[model samples]
Target chain A: MNAPAAQSVSPAPQQGGRPSPPALRFDNVTLGYDRHPAVHHLHLDIAPGSLTAIVGPNGAGKSTLLKAAAGLIRPLDGVIQRGVPARRIAYLPQAAALDNSFPLTVYDLVAMGLWERCGLFGRIGQRHAPRIAEALRAVGLTGLERRPIGALSGGQLQRALFARLLLQDAALILLDEPFNALDAATVADLTALIHRWRDEGRTVLAALHDLELVRASFPQTLLLARELIACGPTDVVLTDANLARARRMSEAPDPHAAPCVRAA
Target chain B: MHAIYAWLIGPFVEFDFLRRALVGALALSLSGAPVGVFLMLRRMSLTGDAMAHAILPGAAIGYLLYGLSLPAMTFGGLAAGFVVALLAGAVARLTQLREDASMAAFYLLSLALGVTIVSLRGSNVDLLHVLFGSVLALDDATLILLGAVAVITLFSLAALWRPLVVECVDPGFLRSVSRAGAPTHLIFLVLLVLNLVAGFHALGTLLAVGVIVLPAVSARFWARQVTGMAGVAIIVAALSGWLGLALSYHHGLPAGPAIILVAGGIYVLSLLLGRVGGLVWRALPGRHLEA
Candidate 1:
């Protein structure tokens, strides 16, 4: 299929309508597990208020890259610098990563987003009630606050998770497959919330599988297959040639098989 | 009415030992029941059991060295339990062995060593008292120890409540937001060891876990929230202690095992007839959702 023409998307204004610096920068970074590199030699900058989609075939290290950005996993080599503190970065892992057996209510789960401010000892006072309500309303989960999270359907649970992200009110949001297994209506609602976040001058990096959605909504894209295949405007990065290259590279075996050299 | 009063209140009113046993059991239940609730929630019920057994060797060693000294035995049991937990955690992290398997192995080794040590010096009667406890013979020092442990456990649990809940629900999320994740987990382990140590003084290593775990599991069938479950567990534990003490006084049975058996009976009853998630509820034709 033919790739769409490149579209120029402007960055949203910061608070007081001022321009902001880059939200994140990766300088020669390598991320891995058990000393086997998953994202290798990455050099990139994610500008503040930019909505970027990361897409590629399976084993593309998309989740690994996001984890590194969130500081959940340290870089094996080089550095990943963030403009904001770790608490100001919100990460929503895949739905399956959460333990549903926990006997937490939707309200209890959503209120955890305030943990950065309230901490372990602090109580959720009346002052924070409005924000929690607003977040739940944004995600269309208002009436289900008292319901147990385990009782929620998949779509409702996704909505509740989004409500939690809303309450986090972070400057940088990283979502890994937020739309997976969600219904079309839920996807549309969440996609709208993402756009609203971008418009509010928050940086959002989503690892997505839907190329059509990326092309339609996201202005920038990072295509990867263990290594950076292409990074630029969505139209330029999602080209037929780049996609084919990513697929081939992902399927091929490493020719130089050797023990990983630890960084000094 | 007089017959009922005689069955319930006469044992405590007539005998100081029965009164002491009741107080000790209630104190243990107040703290240990909540810990047990968290244990069941975290799926660490078996770990609690193993830790109880692991304390035996240290207590036995203390018995050998000091001859039934309460302080020595308490210290030894706490040390041994902590050591086993640390070793099990380290082994799980450093090696390919799963946590459950490592804990099981360590606990079995500890139990065997404990029994061997106890058999080396103490008479069979001493061994029986050590293994099954002498709740009816609680001294002033033991009563004071149980009371102190309950107070400390309640305060610490209150302070650590939020972090502990966050860790249990979503550890990765907790780690992402704050640096307290590891400390929270460590505090929880320490609390578990503390409760186990407290429990050993009243019910012995073999039966202490029953006092903690049975009431907690029984509460699970009746309550949907953690706080409610803890409350129910405390009630069940306290009730079992009261009834068991009365039964022991009337029939002259061993107090510790009698208490545990009462808790076990409640657990079985709750499993069948509780209002929250009981077997009876599941068997109902129209029931759909879990409480």
Candidate 2:
């Protein structure tokens, strides 16, 4: 399958040189469900147009952080300042987050990427068709437009989701475990798309499990173990000492920990 | 040829009550069936059934307040349904119980309370009428109410269609992108309660949900998209109403149960023969597609 160039899809308009602010700033943010803090004492600043990998052990709150950035959850304490509007943000949660059993065609699902532009009642005119078709073509899903999403293979579904993301033309993209259970080829194709988005100057944050892929592709990395372990160049953050500390901190979670109260 | 006419068309043509009943059933089918399809898609079919029962107390209160007044009972039923829905949701959020469990508890109480309230003032005949419904007794006022409900339900469904679909498919995504998710959900609940209130007038509280749910579930076998499923559901529901009413005319059977039973039969047939994922289609191993 060919990896069609995404330039024909909505290209991000060129912005001339200007002092860039942090794409996101997490100020002492604490996020969890039901007062149980999955992420605590986190302070980080993400530069504009940076492709960062958030790596952590199981239960280390990678998904939680992305969700907070997407404004899906409120911070239990402190603040997270997102530089983009909700419409300018595109979030691709885990595959399990979507109801794959829903009866939707690939074309229709991809068309949803036009939501920010068309809105609830806006018509999808003749002009919009080519954009949707180009998105599908970019992700190698051109011929499968009519197929029901339930009939799609895992790889094809992920590709279709990527097509939707491509159409989003978002300034900031948050991906939560996007490549789990996918073939190597699918991963490669998707990674290429991510690179294209980065080239077009979009801030991309991905919660990833694959250290090798992160090392090769992601320039910056944030290692988390319920708290900020390290954030720097991928090589520096993924060091032996930092990895061991992350694993140790994430291993034991107190079931009966007292209600957290931290003074600034 | 005349026998066909006598069997199928004669009863509807001859009796004014039969014609009214047919129109009432068709209205329910048009509006209620699509709502059922959404309920089924959301896996809230039983919840819809529970909600149908939850309106009993409200209608009963109306019946108690004004003797068989349509407007009173309709308002009471609507208020009651909304109260129960909100109560169940609150209970689920505040306490350890899930929404379904709380809904179940509320509906049972509502049903019993409604029945007691009705028997407090009315006779066994009236109790039967409230429980089993009186399709043959539908008046012009009731007919107009049914038509209006159909129009409102369809228009609301169309207006909220996109957000509703996004909410169903990926709620977290919807929440992230737009605020339409929660408001759209609230409006959908209103539609559900409204349809149930309208349905109860024709089919009674106990059996109103049957017309709503049966056609929606059956539609799953035939269509693989929301629009297709709703279309199939409307057709199946309308057909069931016609056949069920015809059966009542010829066999001296009760009308509500007869209609539901015909819908049940269609559900079974769709289960066997439907093209998308029906039993027979699944059972037969078809040729694999070329990649």
Candidate 3:
């Protein structure tokens, strides 16, 4: 990795969006597991309200970096500071490892988002009810508020969690593989929600494995393989050389975008 | 008629012993339900069991020192459980071994150590109280101590309720909000040890866990949410305690085992009767035709 492509380094993205005081900024972020560095010397400012992606191959530390940003894991070295004062951040984990035996309803599941605001001893106020209802409706689960999460199909379960994200009323959302194990329709539905969030001046950072989805949805990309390969506007970052290096450093190149090259 | 009256309704009106037992049972459930819920979630009820057995040695030593004071024995036991859990947590975090493996090691070592201490320091009567418990011997001071412990456990749970449930359900989300759950988990462990120690005289180590676990487990069959489950567990626990104590008083059977057996019975019934998915519930009509 070299300039125009930094090695063991991360740089400002070429979004022309005026860095925008990044809703999230990674200043020389060196991340990993057990003190073994995974993503190195990474620096990127996610433009406020922009839907930026940390895209990469299996061992590329895609999940690792996202986990770091979510504060689930502290970086081996470096800081991840949220823009603005401490804000409401929503995180949708890699499909909940929830005990299926738990037997919670979709309404109950979505309403959990209010836990931060409502506090435990108090009841969910009448004011919060409409938000819960609106969230379910937004996720196309209008009448299914009472549906047991344990009984939901994979897609429905995904949307229910989406409803939770909606109810969180958070400015920053970090989704880890939210699209995994979903059908095409579910993906389309979630993509629409992502689009809505980006349009609303809310910051969205999603870690995705699908290159085509990343290309279509996000303007800025953070390509990685334990080090940032390239991060900028899709056109600049998705170049053939970058894709090839990404592919070579990565496991398999999607032939759909085979050349991944746009002619001049 | 007298026997029937005593067995059926003696708990509410008759002996002060019945009042104490009833109150004791209610307190036990209040403390135990939340503890059981977390243990089941963390998959660390076995650690709770380890603490229970570990407390026996401290309890035995406390008795040797102070001659069978509930406060002395229970406080010593709680101290012992707390130390063991902290050491286990520390070992798990610092060493290559994971939490479950470290807890297992702590458990076996504690149980062995407890047996040694009891054999070395305890007399026959002390041995009986240490292992089997003395639920029949209800003193006013002991009841008050148990009641106070239950109140603190309930209030702490109420104050820390949502965070604890959220932590168990989704540590990732909780962590994302910058609330790492290790400390929260330690707090839960301490509460569990206190409940185990508090309920020790009412039900012995093995039997107390049964009383604590069974109601919460049984209640899950009826609840779709954490709050609902907890509420149901409290109700079932109190009911079983009152009824079992009354039955024991009437028949002169051991009160601890009687209460535990009632809880166990509820669990078995719940297992047979639980309805998890819509498939089983919806199958009732269609299956009737098929049959």
Candidate 4:
């Protein structure tokens, strides 16, 4: 029942001629509801140390693609190859996914990432302790460790999740809409955190909604709308043509928008 | 007075059963407190009710085979409860039915199955005892089993604590973070079922739930954090259990329900007087404080 986490690790250092494995690969991946496909022929590669944002309007399968990568929903076709098993992948889902009524502290919320390493019916170890503290510190949540999670603001909760991602010590991290309900300041702080993670040789794939923020922040893009509309550099892919195509895709359901320009 | 105090405290001061009842209450409180806190959050205290009922058929089977062996029956009951919960989970996921509907259905099915199983053995008296436990009948064997289950539940809770909390509050996001949320939650419910079954021998079905429920409910008014709530719950449960025993020694009412009632009374008191969850606090005097 636990969702598979997408990690924030680099192509794990390898020996011999095994070229560094792609951080994530969706090869001809067709994903959708039972028998009905949403996103099809989705061939995409996520390079290590790269921060790729999967952006599209609502119902665009942006969340779906991330879910497929995390192995939450079985892809209708194709495989989601990771450098290692799904365990090495750390995931930070959207803040909206959390129920605030749960009675736990910020510290308790972050501690769950270490459960897999704890072994079944096993005791916690000394080595993982420092990492937990370090992760919390990295998020600037050192003193708010024991604060009840329910009491935290949206930004604090998001940071707490980032701390959990840190606990995974993963080479790659997949985050879905992690900055949806944040203030401008929080968005900036989280953006800085993402940059820091990427600078540390980690790859971060996020599903972001803010177009300007996505353009300003992430260098890579995966423009999706029930399909892989475009996949490449932000500047290249966010061109008027692709943007118009994306806008057309967005207007598909509405039917009330102006006609999109097909640039040469 | 000295002689009377000796009679009151002597059994506890010397023999082990009296000591264990208190210890058992503490253990039950440790689990029940968090369970109560979560139940409040989820509004699924009813699930606890259904789970309590579900343990019956399993415990009845264990008892029919083992002749009141606490460990034997507890393990059986725990396993049965887990199966029922799994069935409920599957039903919720596969069908359009909500989790509450699944819980209600499972509760009735398991309760009936247990009664049918008990009738197969033709021991109405035994079933009644299991239904309403006589804690005085709980021997050292039951205590040991309770202790083991308690330890396992505690360790599991601690290990999965972080993800479980996150999952409970924000399962959608919890899903993306790591595959830690829902699995941890399933495992937690399994552990909860195990604890309830373990309490079956000493606490009975009805009172076991009450014990599991009220201490934490009462403690909620006093604490905001999980750790604080757990601490207060243990204290409340231990006190109630000890007080119930004393009251029972003086008046010949049943011990388990008496213990639960004491806890319920504490809950009532908290509701009236507590600054947080109590009823009247959100009204006149509360408004006056702000003014």
What value of lDDT does candidate 1 attain over all alpha carbons?
0.87
- Ranked by DockQ, the better of candidates 1 and 2 is 1
TM-score of chain B of 3: 0.89
Tell how far residue B53 is off in model 3, in angstroms: 0.9
Candidate 2 chain A weakest lDDT stretch, 10 residues: A1-10
**What is model 2's DockQ versus the real complex?**
0.57
For candidate 4, what is the DockQ-based docking class?
Answer: acceptable
Docking class of 2: medium
Q: Could you give candidate 1's per-residue lDDT for residues B1-291 as a string of tens digits?
A: 999999999879998988999999999999999999889888999999999999999999999999999999999999999899999999999999999999999999999999999999999988887788889889999999999999999999999888888788888888788888878777778888888888888888889898889999999888878889999999999999999999888898888989998999999999999998799878885746685
Query: What digit string (tens of lDDT, one per residue) describes model 2 on residues A122-148?
Result: 887788999999999999998999998
iRMS of each prediction: 1.3, 1.3, 2.7, 3.4
Ten contiguous residues minimizing lDDT sum, candidate 4 chain B: B282-291
Off by more than 4 A, model 1: A1-20, A251-256, A259-264, B287-291
lDDT of each: 0.87, 0.89, 0.75, 0.74
How many clashing residue pairs, candidate 2? 0
Q: Tens digit of lDDT per residue, candidate 3, span A61-122? A: 88877777766778777688887444377877777776545556788778887866775456
TM-score of each: 0.94, 0.94, 0.87, 0.79
Instruction: List ranges where model 3 is wrong by over 4 Å.
Output: A1-19, A78-81, A119-123, A250-264, B1-4, B10-14, B178-180, B274-291
Q: What is the lDDT of residue A58 in candidate 4?
A: 84
Q: For all the predictions, what are the DockQ values? A: 0.63, 0.57, 0.44, 0.37
Candidate 3 vs candidate 4: the lDDT winner is 3
Please tell me which model should have the higher DockQ, number 1 or number 3: 1
Model 2's C-alpha root-mean-square deviation from the true structure amounts to 5.7
Q: Order the numbered candidates by lDDT, best leading.
A: 2, 1, 3, 4
Residue pairs in candidate 3 whose N, alpha carbon or C atoms collide under 3 angstroms: A2-A5
RMSD to the true structure for each prediction, in A, is 3.7, 5.7, 5.9, 7.0
